[model samples]
Target: MTVLQWTATLVGLSFALYIGIAIWSRARSTSEFYVAGKGVHPLANGMATAADWMSAASFISMAGIISFLGYDGSVYLMGWTGGYVLLALLLAPYLRKFGAFTVPDFVGERYYSQTARVVAVICAIFVSFTYVAGQMRGVGIVFSRFLEIDIALGVVIGMGIVFFYAVLGGMKGITYTQVAQYCVLIFAYTVPAIFLSMLITGIPIPQIGLGAAEQETGTFLLDRLNGLHEELGFAAYTDGTKSMLDVLAITAALMVGTAGLPHVIIRFYTVPRVRDARISVGWALVFIALLYTAAPAVAVFARTNLLNTVTDAPYAEMPDWFTKWEATGLISFEDHNGDGLIQYVGADAVDGTGQPVRNELTIDRDIMVLANPEIARLPNWVVGLVAAGGLAAALSTAAGLLLVLSAAISHDLLKRNWRPDISEKGELIAARVSAGVAVIVAGYLGINPPGFVAEVVAFAFGLAAASFFPVIILGIFSKRLNREGAIAGMLSGITLTAAYIVYFKFVNPAANVAENWWFGISPEGIGALGMTVNFAVAGIVSRFTPVPAGKEGRDPAEVRELVERIRVPRGSGEAHEVSG
Candidate 1:
């Protein structure tokens, strides 16, 4: 069969399998809808968590950015994976012990205020929407490239699939589906990487192959990459230009944000035991690290392979990969001096006489991973496998995010706080309806994206860091923190971070520079500043305010009980009743 036909077959079969699971495990109650009846096993939950966490940014754009950013890209690697450590150590087990349906449920109940719950619902929706848009865009890209379909149509196809499982079976459907997705995505990601690593270095392991001697040149792989960069007047693959402090801020923000994201946090609440929550985090990290470690190796291989193929070559002799990417407008060439040869270099590169050199090649960083198999001249099946993997990465995360959105609207907002008399069947119906609405909204945004996939996803992390991380941590560890403090911290942090990103990214694009940035930190790194502000505001506000009291004046006692329950770890409490 043809490559496109094979891709269609695999993607179709995968979709059918997921849908069948959704039908078989359709949610019967609000409990099944919201937290999967809190019955998920640790190993299974870990696989689902891994699928939920590794979005399109992880599977597709990360390697591409690493190829161009060199050492600077370590921020993504360090920030994302490192955050799992914080989740395991600080947040996951405790949240599980709380036995809540969602993050807002914990925030609202812990603070003893419906006001706090409402605010958390807003933040959850905002962050989830921001994150899911990127996933939908990834779905569009995969479809557009592999199936020769329009991006809009691809998003619709992705939306239809997600709506089927998420709306029909809620968390129960998404959990099992994500496990299948993890298997598909991980296999797809590793297989091409293994093949390319073997081809480039004659070594089976990508991480070791990245540093070993190239089979043909007998020179270290990194050394050859460096030589190519120098010859082309580009930054060395081992070096970068971002300042250390900026890197630190970005990495720190991503770590905290990854730990605090509502979708990932909700995964902990699905497990029946607190210990499972703790161990599941470790397993999820192991799954994530598999792809995280391999990404840089793939980046190195693609960069080195492209340079070797294109440098000093005639325009007419360009490889098929070049032509294909060029068609996507992700790669372009201009022969300014009328020479048929392409010269790709940094604008700062110059001749000995101080005359600036013009780079003829323009390549988008996002195409690196997608074009890897083609660049290596691998089989069409490998390319098809990569397509399936990218879709799995995108669709799995999108489904998880939509489920959270539905939980926030149907569980947290409607049933728990606003309309407390809603019946179980009614709430279940609301979950499906909300998921459907979210899918449609996400599809629209995907067709008209706010930014590149990875960049938009970074905004989600920044929002999570600013709004959720500080308050949630303080709620668990600091017994004196009050409702007013949590509210103030969340509002202040989210406001400042959102305003900065909007101003720099949209209002005055030219002002987005190191010289003009606050503390030399770009908008991408501003979450660190926001997080610090949250910590300070909450501390100061709590010190000045009275301890929160419920209508019956028992909030302080309730808070004490909450702290004790989460800490004891022996008896994780019952999952919240899903019926309003």
Candidate 2:
């Protein structure tokens, strides 16, 4: 089948599956709606969490970034995956033991203040909306290219699918549908990567294949990539040009940011026990590692293939996929000396006069992963699989983020505050309405994206790390953190980070000096710095102020009892003990 046919068939089937799951598992109560009735199997919840966490950025843009940036891209791989370790170790289990429907609920009850809860709701909405915008745009891009639809119409179609299941099934619908999406996306990502790996290096596993000796060149695969990069005037693939301090800061920001994201943290709430939450993260990582490990290999193979095919080949002989992508204005070729052949070289290759000796081509880095299989002469079905995978990644993440967005509005903002006595049915309707509103907002943002996918996603992660992670961690672990301190800390962190990013990314066009950065860190990594400042400020302020009466301490007996129950395995047929 052609790419369009395969995309239509696979995407249609996936949508049908989601609708069926939503119908069969329609949430009947608030608990079911928010946390999937708290009966989801650990493994199943793990798969859903994997899908929830791996957004369109991971599926479509990560390898492309790695391809263009080379070793600098390792920061993303390490930062994103390492954050799961922090999640499992520091946050997930305790939140599960708290037995709340959302992260804000835990913060409110733990801190004994509605103000803290409201601050958390605001943070959740900001992080979810910023992150979901990229997913919606990714969905539109996939549809426009593979489904032969306009990008705006594609976004609307994707929005409608999200509305169908997210409104009806809530977390229950999202969880099961995410499990199916995980399967489709993972298969779609890995199969083509394996094919490319075998074709290039004669190795099946991309991770090992990347390090193995190349059949064509007697050197290691990475060494070959590095050699090719230098020949093309680009930085070596195994070494980075960024300063050590910047790399460390960026990695730190992404790690803490990953742990702080509301959508990911809320996934732990769906499991039945604390141990399930802990073990489920390991499973989620296993699934994530499948694509993460393959991504580097895809980057190496695709870059090599692109350089070989386009470097000396005439424009008329260029591949069909090249013409197709170039028509979208994503790929371009310039013949500076009227040489006819496209030159793929680094920016630094130009002479001291700031003029190129050869023609330069500029290709959008985002197209690398999507066009890799086709560029390498892989079967049409493999290209179709990638399209499906990209859709699954975007749709699953959009559903998860939309769920959090609606819950924050309905449960935290309205049910908890505006109408404390609102009926469960009323709240459910509110949640659906909130979800519909979020979809419209996300669709609009997708149609007119603010920036490139990876950069925008990084900014969102930085915000989450700086503003939310510190608040949630201190709320649970520090008894001295007062409502005033949490609010002050979040406001300060978010404000400072936003100002820094806006100034650097948009405000100052002519002044781009590294010395202007505070602490020698870029705005991309400054969120970690902001988070540290927040924690210090909160700690200092809490010391000077008196703790709210009756809210200064956790029940030690209850805490111990909860710990013991979570430590034990489930299905023992005994009533779990609780103390207060």
Candidate 3:
């Protein structure tokens, strides 16, 4: 079989395995639908969380970004991984002890108001949909490239597979399916890095290979890469272009957003106890760091290889992968000065012939990981494995996000707020049906991607940092925060962040430069500002509002009891069943 056929077979088998697992593990109760009956082992839950957290952006686009952006990409490395630290220490144990099924459930019960629940649900839905759009788009990209199909048809195939498993098994199916995906993706990601590292730096471990000496030049791998970058008119790989303040802002926003994201937080609900949640976070990070740490090394290898092989080579000497990717428009070339030799520059420049040469090569960052196997000249099976890995990353994340979308619509909106009398069975049906609808909507977004996968996902993080992170933290750590204060803070934070992003992205994109940015922070990183706004607004408004009581109104005795319950970790057992 051809390379494309091999990729199709492997990916097909992987999807079939997930669907079979879903069929065998159908959710029977509302609790099962949402949290898999709260019986998942900590280690297993950690694997599932890794799959949930590392989406298409992580698996496919992140290395490409690092390859191009150089040191600026450290923001993602620190921001995404650091959030798990906050999640473990700040939120996970407490939420697990609270025994809530969803982030909205925690908000509603903590504030003792349906209004808080409604607000939480909206934020959760918005953040999840924004994130899911990237996953769906990721699926299409993998299918288009590997399976050799139309992008729209690729989305349809992805949606059909996801809809079957997601609608059938809910969280129960998703949790188990994620475990399978984690294995496939991580293996796919690391093998290429290991092979390339050995070839370039003579080290098998990627992290160490980065700092090791280059086999050819005897200089450090990093030093060699920087030399190549400067020679080619690109930024040094270790030095960054963005201001430190913007870097700090973007990193903070991503960390908080990672902790606050509902799909990720909800993974803790599946584990059996509060202690399990804490341990699970450690394991999840361990699994995630495996990829996160290696990605930069992969970037280094890919960058070094491209510069060595492509630059200054004759057009006829270019590899087959270049031609294939060029056909997709992910890569393009034009000998602007009509020189037969390729000239790649980060800026407009003259070639060796002193001809004013416009850069011939245009490489999209999204294709970096997808094209890595080819760049390394690996075997056909390895190339096919990378395709399976990309699908795994996209599908795993999409299932987790769609679960929250459907559950919030059915449980939070229909059952809790609108029709309190609805039966649990009816609620489950609603969850499944809503999941189906979400699949189609997500597929449409995939066919017409809004932006780069990671860029769009970053917007979701900004909103989460603005809306959910502060309120949830305050609700746990502070007694003075009232329902009115939380509502106001969420509205203020989300509204301001949304306005900033919409203005730069849609309203007046030309004004997106540093001078035009408010305080020189980019829209991607503005969530840090919005998060601060949330904290400040909550603190200011909380003092004026009457202290909220317990469920009916916080009596002093009930307030103390409420604090003591979540504070003490003794009673966190199986979560009681409710509508999913």
lDDT of 3: 0.87
- For candidate 3, the per-residue lDDT at 223 reads 92
Q: What's the TM-score of each model vs. the native?
A: 0.96, 0.93, 0.96
Candidate 2 regions exceeding 4 Å error are 350-355, 509-515, 550-580
lDDT per model vs. reference: 0.87, 0.82, 0.87
Name the candidate that leads on lDDT: 3
Q: What is the C-alpha lDDT profile of model 1 across 1-580, one tens digit per residue?
A: 6668878988888889899989988889887888888889989999999999999999988888888878888788889888999999999988888888999988887787778888999999998998999999999888887787888999999999999999998898889989999999999999999999899899999988888999998999888888878766788879878888889888888999998899999998888888889879988988888999899899899888878777768989987767766766668999987889987777567777878889888887777888888888899888888899899999999999999999999988898767788988998998889999999999998898877788888888988999999999998888888889999999999999999999999999899899999889888888888999999998999999876665522356867777776766675445333111
Ranking by lDDT: 3, 1, 2
Question: Candidate 3: worst 10 consecutive residues by lDDT?
Answer: 571-580
Q: If both were scored by TM-score, which would come out higher, candidate 2 or candidate 3?
A: 3
lDDT of 1 at 73: 83
Residue-wise lDDT of candidate 3 within 1-580, one digit each (tens)? 6678889889988998999999998899988998898889999999999999999989988888888898998898889989999999999988887777889887776776789889999988888988899999889888887877777898999999999988889899999999999999999999999999999889999999988999988999889888888777787889999999999999999999999999999999998888899989999999999999999999888888888878878988888878777766677778876778888886735557866656778887888898888887998888999999999999999999999999899988898789888998999999999999999899988888767888888888999999999999998888778788888888899889989999999899999899999888999899999999999998899888777655532343454456566666675454333222
What stretches of model 3 exceed 4 Å from their correct place? Answer: 348-356, 549-560, 571-580
Candidate 2 clash pair list: none
Clashes of each: 0, 0, 4
Off by over 4 Å in 1: 351-354, 550-554, 571-580
